[model samples]
Target: MPESWNYLMDMDGVLVHEEHPIPGASEFVAELTGNDIKFLVLTNNSIYTPRDLRARLARTGLDMPETAIWTSALATAKFLDSQRPNGSAFVIGEAGLTTALHEIGYVLTDRDPDYVVLGETRTYSFTAITKAIRLVEEGAKFIATNPDATGPSREGSLPATGAVAALIARATGREPYFVGKPNPLMMRSALRALGTHSANTLMIGDRMDTDIRAGLEAGLQTILVLSGISADSTAEMYPFRPTRVINSIADLVGNSAAPF
Candidate 1:
C-alpha cells in the first residue's frame, strides 16, 4: 500500500543517536523500504556529507544509500551555486562543509567572496570569527546551515553551528539566511528530489524546535521519535505538537495505526 506520505526523515535522533543506532530505528526505516516508501535523511548537520552519514549508519547496522540522504553541506553548496555564477565563499566551518562546497565548484577563498557560509567550526578561533564578520559586513551574503545552538555528540551536546553563526550575525547586524531544517529551503530541495509535495509526505525527526517545526512550516505531517534530542518531558513546552510521537520507530505496528 502507498503510504499517505512520501517521507523525508531526519537522521540524528530519529535514526542514529550520536554515532550509534537508536534501537528500532532500523525497523521503522525497514518498514518504509518494505513498503516502497520514498524517503530521504534530511539533516541540517553539515559536519558530515551524505556519504559520510551513510557510512556512519552502516557501522551502526543501518545501510542506507548515499542517494537516500541529504545534508546541509550539500544544500548550502547547491544554494550558493544558484546564487552566484562563480561565487567565492568564505566558510567558517568543518572540513566536511568546505569539502562539500568545493565539490559543487565553489571557490573557497577568505580574501574575496560573494557569500559567507557558517557551520560548526571545530577551530572556533577569534581570527576566524572576526574575518567572517568582516566579510559579511563588507556586503557578502550571510548563510548558515541551520540555527542550532549546539551540536549533538555522544558526550552530550555542545555549542553548535548556530552559535558560531550568531557571533557573525551579531557583529554585522544581520541574521543568517538559514538553509537547514526549520527553514523552507531544505524541504523545498527535498520536495524537488522526491518530485512530490507535502500532502503525500511525512517528516520524522527528533527535535521539535528544528525538525518538527521545519516540517510543519513546509506543510508535511510530523513524527517525533524520542531517541535523540527531544525527550518526552521536553516536548510539553512546545507551542505546537507533533502529529505523532513514538518511543522508537520499531513500536510502529502498521501504517494504519499511530503511536501518538
Candidate 2:
C-alpha cells in the first residue's frame, strides 16, 4: 500500500462551488492522481449517481473514476442493504433521493410506507407532512438523508435537508434516522470504499459541524479548508477543531510534488 496519507473529501465547498469549479480546484484534484494519494470524493449531497458525479467532475477536468466517488445517497443505500429488511419508503426529496433508495432496493411508496424519508423537499405541503407523520405513527422508521439546516444557494441560502426532516419530526413527535455527516454511517462507508486505515486518512471539508465531526467519529485526522463555506472566525470559536487549517487545497499539494 502507498505510505502517503489517504484523503476523504467533501464536495461543494472543498471542491467545486455550485456548478463552477473553485479556483485551482481542478488542478488540486489532478495532483491527487499524480501523487497516488488514494483520495476519494465523499460528498453529503444525496443528489447524483456515482456516474453522474464523475461526469460532472470531468467537465472541470477532474475525471474521477466512478468507483472513487461515494455520495450520501449511496451510503444510505448501503446502510439499508446491510439491514436486509424489505420495506417501502415515502421520500420527500427530488429524483436523486428516490433514485438512490430504489437503487439500494428500498421500495419507495406513498401509500402505507414502511418508512418516511425526508430531505430538501421544495414541494412539501401540510398534507404530505401529515401523511408521513401518520405512517411514522403506524410504526414506520423515519429516516433523513442529512441534517443540514440550510443549503447553499446563489441567492445566499435556503432550507437544507435537515430543516425538512425537522418539520416531519415536529409533526409526528418522533425523531429521524439522519444518515449524513456527523452521523458516522456515511464516514464508515467512505472508509470501506477507500480501503484505507482510518487513522492514516485525512478528512478535508468546509463544514466544521458535519465534515470535521464525521472525521473525528471515524477516527481520522481532519483538515479545514477555507475555499468554501467554513469561515476562520467560526473555527476559532468551534467546539470541535480540525488538525490543520489552510486557505485551500492548493496550499498543501499542487501539481508539482508527490503525495506526502
Candidate 3:
C-alpha cells in the first residue's frame, strides 16, 4: 500500500448492512482516523443527510463524523450548482435530497422549474410521479440521484429512484441523467471533495456493476468486498474486475500492509 493512499468507501455493504455495522468495520474506520488518513464514506442512498447518516451509523456501532460521509444527494447538488448556480428544481424525495439542494441555493418549486429531480424515498407517491412526468414533458430536464432500480429493506426489495426514473422516462420519452454510482461524475466529485488524486486513492465497495465500475472509470484502484450485494462468483460475470476481492472489511482490519 502507498504511504499516502486515501480511501473512498461505499457505506452500505462495505461498512454497514441493513442499519447494522459489519464486523470489524468500526475498527477499520478507527484505524484510518487514528492514522490521520484521509477517507470518505460514500453512499448511493439519497434518503438521508450526512448528519442523519452519522447518527444512524453511531447507533450501529460505527462512530463517524458527518464530514467523513458523502451521499448521492450531495453529489447531485454539487453537480447542479456547477451546471447552473442557484437553479430551481421540482424535487421528489425526502429531507436528504431537499436539504442538499436547499443548501446549494436551489429553489424547490413546481412551476416552470429548471429540473425534475428524483431520489430514494420510502413511499412512492403516484401524485408526485405524475407531476414529475408532466414537468419533464414540459421541458424540465430530468435528473436522478442514482441508477439503482431497487433498494434493500427488512421485508424485501423496494422500488428505488431508477425504477421511478424509468417510469418517468417511459412517459416523457426522455432519460434522466444519473448523478450517483456507476457515473464517474460522482466519483470525481468525491475525489475532489477529499482533495486527493485517483492514483493514490482506493475505492472499497461491494457491488461490481456500480461501485467497482465507477471507481475504475474514475481512474482509481478498486476493491470488491463480499459483504454486500455481490457474491464471490458475482465478479466473474462483470466485464471488468476489482484490483482485490476480499471476504469483508474485517479482513482489512489491522492489516494495512496486506495487498489491496
Q: Which candidate model has the greater TM-score, 1 or 3? A: 3
**Model 2: lDDT to the true structure:** 0.79
Off by over 4 Å in 1: 1-4, 154-156, 253-260
Cα lDDT tens digits for candidate 1, 1-260: 23356778888777777677887777767777787777888888888777777888888989778989888887777788777766788888886689878887888898878888888655678888899888888888899988888875567768888887777777889899988878878887888877888877788888898888988998888888887778888789998989888876666636522333
* lDDT, candidate 2, 98-191, per-residue tens: 7878876788888877778776555667787788888998888898888888877778877777887787788778999888898888988888
| lDDT for model 3 | 0.93
Q: Give the per-residue lDDT of model 3 (tens digit) for 23-96.
A: 99999999888978889999999999999999999999898899989999999999999999999999999999
Compute each candidate's TM-score over C-alphas. Answer: 0.90, 0.90, 0.98
| Cα displacement (Å) at residue 81, model 2 | 1.6
Alpha carbon lDDT at 237, candidate 2: 78
Report model 1's TM-score to 2 decimal places: 0.90
Off by more than 4 A, model 2: 255-260
* Ten residues in sequence with the least summed lDDT for candidate 2: 251-260
Q: Enumerate residue pairs that collide in model 1.
A: 6-200, 150-160
